[model samples]
Target: MTPTAVDASIQRVARFGATERRLHTIHASAFVVMFLTGLVLYVPTLAQVFSNRPVVKGIHLVAAAAWLTALALVAVLGDRRALRRTRREIERFDADDLRWLRRRTPSPQGRLNAGQKVHAILQAALALLFTVSGTLLWLSERNTDLRLPGTIALHDWSMILAGVLVAGHVWIALSPDKLPALRGILRGTVPAGWAASHHPKWQAPPAGSAQRAPRAGPVRLVAAAVVVASGLLVTAAFTGLAFT
Candidate 1:
């Protein structure tokens, strides 16, 4: 191959940008805070060892709030083009992805593979569930009419599920083969060879070439509408429940 062709083939690719890196950092820090505080609050041994229930609970609540706020800010201020690209990558599961999942073929993925996409969606849903349930549990502290036991049950169960998922996520992220992906999130780029091997479908732009900013498409508009509608519906239902 010619020098130009080789240069094109081995060019470094942008994986995560500044905004994505910041968001991931915020989420990771919040998760660590919440998880540690939660363990202290939930575990009998840790509770005794900590011997400061209120402080632990306070820290957990603050972490939860921070996590939620970070997510809200990202939704409001993050680049829509980047978000759309990520969503499309995560949502698309072709035959290659399936074959890779089944171990029937080598990894033929784009920016995100099936496992990462599934994990991202599941974690997002779990975070939402945890937030709702935690809020209900908090409200139950002041309102006797609110079903405390049910809220507690929901919150506890959600936390347990989230904890398990987080453990798996950590295991995968820290694994030897996946460490480069973690580094990409931290540094906003990965080696061209690594990208080429693991994500064969990802086409890296030529070295030092600028990537064009994508415009908002119909799919993005529809997705935003759906999210807004869902948020409204959920808020209305919660308000009704609170009043009645």
Candidate 2:
């Protein structure tokens, strides 16, 4: 085969497996829950706009905390595997993909465009902000001695911004042309053709076969289990073990 034909064939081999898709779906769902719950909790004025203010607020706060825990687990525990896979795909972006991503015209594969990449990074950063702000808010409200200036303001504003950003993320997720990307999340399987079109280099192998530096084992798992169990116990102390 000629050099150009060989390059084309090489590009067709990269694809993400069902595992990554499952992770992405879980992340997306968790973020959506966190965002909506945060909205209901933070915007008391919306109580007038919507009904059952206090109940909604409670639900929102609880969901946001749960999602935060879940996301933290995903990041700390799953990052090693996820980052490796995403990097392989992202690194393979060539001039054509870049141009297609930036162009006004729609793409055939509708892979995550450049905007999605930026938003993903921003979402990660915002998750950090939510963690810090939330902890501070919780502390300030509980302890009389712990005085944090702008704690209330920061929490409120950060949540508001996160809400807006999440809306954008959802819009992108629901975009008409990106059905395949959405399906990848829901069905936990991107067809081989879909992966070939979107991520040319991710088709490296059938996942789990990639060799990389050894990572810490099950530390994140134990940590997550402890945290979730503790949080549940504490919550049960007041709310009767409401797992919802």
Best candidate, lDDT: 1
Candidate 2 structure lDDT: 0.56
Per-model TM-score on C-alpha atoms:
0.77, 0.64
How high a TM-score does candidate 1 get?
Answer: 0.77
Q: On residues 9-112, what C-alpha lDDT tens digit does candidate 1 reach at each position?
A: 45456678666777788888888897788778778999999997776776677666656656655565557567677778888889888987788467678778
Local accuracy of candidate 2 as per-residue lDDT tens digits, 104-219: 45443324455665566676677677778766665555576666887768777877777788777778778876676665556433445556655543423432332333454787
Top TM-score: which candidate number? 1
How far does residue 102 in candidate 1 sit from its true spot (Å)? Answer: 3.3
Please report, in order, the local distance difference test score of every candidate based on alpha carbons.
0.71, 0.56
Model 2: how large is the Cα RMSD against the reference? 6.5
Q: Once superposed on the true structure, which residue ranges of model 1 sit more than 4 Å away at CA?
A: 1-11, 206-244
Distance from true location, Cα of 42 in model 1, Å:
0.9
